[model samples]
Target: MLWLYLHFPHLLLDHIRRTREETGALVIVEGSGQKVIQACPEARDQGVHGGMRLKTAISLVPELGTVRADQQQEARILEDQARWLYRYAAHIVLVPPDGLMAEIGSLQRLYGGLPAAWQTVEQALDERQLIAWPGLGHTPLAARLIARAGKGECTDDKGHIQRTLGQMPLLAAEFDARTCTRLQRLGLNTLGEVFALPAAELARRLSPETLARVQKIQGTRPDPQAPWQPPHHFRQQADFVQEIEQSQGLLFPLQRILAELEEDLCWRQQETDSLLLVLQHRHEEPSRLRIRTSGPEHRAEAFLNLVRLRFEQHPLRAPVMSLQLSVKRFLGREADTGQDLLGESQDLNEAWHTLMSRLQARLGDQALQQLSPQADHRPERAWTASGVQRNNRPAATMNDQLPRRPLWLLQGPQPLTEAPTAWFAGPERISGGWWDGQRVHRDYYIAQLHNGQLAWVFRDVRDGWFVHGWFG
Candidate 1:
């Protein structure tokens, strides 16, 4: 089974910026630095293109709308789109900020074949007001290339993969800029020309190696892709009456989101063990917040409890526009009487969700937070405050018996004036990983200091005494 790879090479950052700034205006964004990111179709019609210098492109179409490409922002929106599309296909491969590939082989059968599946996907995207060109083929590469060449629909051909692909320009092969130029100069502008060349001869002609790539795209060699998998059976979402800012605003919104999720859990006949919430903000990347249950839960109230506690301590830093919740792990659903209550229980969930909504209306995403585990063994390294739905694990947990640790560690250890330890544990000397050049070598000690602060101190073989962490 091949795949449906959709390419949006021209859906550049300029289009987004312009679409926001001037509706119906043709825009082509060129990154200020070295790389070209996007050129609008209108700009392309004027002979502008991706990778063309911004100034040169403007010279081609003096009136062309231009903006510096925000690669980060474009990528964020693309990811959010990918996240939403997970509901359609379990396996989705994002082709970065502009495109995606979905394993539609299995989906085709479910949707009653290729065309039907394509239509279903198109319809879903339409609801979101996003347009994508779909290309169906036996391989991910083939599908992607054909789609970029603007093949809107795949003709039925169980065996005509090469023939269908023969029509596309060679640039669709994802060749390097120089290779593409070389192909054009040689009048081998089409895939058919490239395909006609004997593999051995073609390999010998290319620089930096082309034999392997040629073989992969030609289907003579297999190119494997690791498909993206959506988490099993859990999601939470909240629709804001208005966009929100501040960590305080999330409390109420999350309340309703949890309530809706509680119902979804019931319908799925599953109990959530661990769930994640993805928060999307206007013009910024979405953040992820995840919670793990000590045990499986179907109770809406209990689920909300954890989210509430997390929000109380941390709030949003920026205003959020939308919220998405997903369950990464879950257990079998078991009916609970509390959630089954007629109206009052549901009301509480609604109230809490409402409160969160109001808080977000004013506080923004940066004001809200949830503590996530850290990987480091240090106490202060235990957790970090992250956006509600941000996915960052806690610091590494090393052997607890390594040494005495501190509960409260300074953000950056403060310099101590005088030595205050009554009893000292032997210094464990360790250092040297300066390849990237942020080097540290210290003799660490467990000391009961003067002010009754049991602290972790280290003396660099050179820098004398420096406090590292504290055991509150």
Candidate 2:
């Protein structure tokens, strides 16, 4: 299998700065035991580094701005990119905040050749203003190392992978400075020298983990990767020659894209569950627009209508050059109820689409959200807001818990002056996320409050009482 590897050294901060259009100002996140989580290139240019003291970063940049790192936001962006890449290949593996590795061996035939496949991947990234150094090899680890080391076009044709990898400094594999220094001391500086050694001898000399790392890079061991799934059949596109400045200019292009998508869906014998619309601009980052039908739908007019509703309520920040519409998520084929005199299904779908489209055209993409259940049994952590196009359902465990959940839960738990509950149903306690050490052990309860409202409450063993949630 051909493994495609990517690495982004400053992915989190780069993504945050880009998406937020935050330039010149530096951002520092003091997360998980007050460690600096990310820093922008501009900040780095001024001598700020990840894990640097936030106070020191500010001292260096002076104008540094900061926000708590939102790993969820970064993860969502990665998920979207994975979905887009899925168009060109079957298996995509997420390497988290900064990387992705994909299996594209089977796609070589479909895209013509390895080079062409790389171009397709490049184009997808180009459309998103994302830069990736891509490398192909037999092992995921080898591909990742090559990509990180800037060997964009490297291939493992004649052990060139092993050779190229050998030439690379040990640090290229993300090994710690101590390990690299240790290897340098033994004249095993290059990965090739390490690879050339007898496995048992190397294991004896350094550590078994050292041998395992070499084995992974050499493809002697299986690298388990979590695969990404692409959405089912759907398509949408926008054509524009003249730049559209005003918000309303988006409508015609969106309608055109929806029309084409409708026709495409009809031909494919499919319906869409979630539609993702990307508005590519001439001078700025693309605006992401998305819409999810209440259920599976194939009616072109209805799809366009929902998007129109979203757009009409939301306005634009930049002029659109062209639009690309695609199904980010979907369900299987379904029978289309053509036209009816009652028009109940048709009218509702079309009306809903139109309303959503107008809202999206006017308000921008972040205006609308759908709710999803979360995995934690704690009612305060029971649900999350999701974008309509990416309607992620909650995990199975989320619904099976005995915790009486609230119909309405505050964004954060409300503190109570006194403790009311003596017995806890779930002294079912949790602790130790404390490596970053923001540990808490709460005695959670499903209790009846004085006002007759069923509340999900918790008492931190150290702190006092906090009303965590409510069950109406």
lDDT of 1 at 459: 80
Best-matching candidate per lDDT: 2
lDDT of each: 0.65, 0.68
TM-score attained by model 2: 0.52
Candidate 2 C-alpha lDDT tens digits along 1-472: 8899877665555444443322575564755526566666677788887888777777787777675655765675566566556666778888887788889888888888888888888886775556677887788888888888888573548477767888887667776677678888987667777778899988898888878888988889777887876545444343343456776666665654576566556655676767888887877888886676656777777776677676666577688765667774545674547654444465565556555645555565578887877665445445787755522244457445454455777677788755454443655465543454455678777776655666677778776777777766
Clashes of each: 58, 38
lDDT for residue 120 in candidate 2, whole number 0-100: 83
C-alpha TM-scores of all predictions: 0.49, 0.52
Q: Once superposed on the true structure, which residue ranges of model 2 sit more than 4 Å away at CA?
A: 21-52, 59-63, 154-156, 175-182, 224-226, 230-472
At residue 11, candidate 1 shows an lDDT of: 49
Determine the C-alpha RMSD for candidate 1 after optimal superposition of all C-alphas.
16.3
- Scored against the true structure, residue 113 in model 1 reaches a CA lDDT of 75
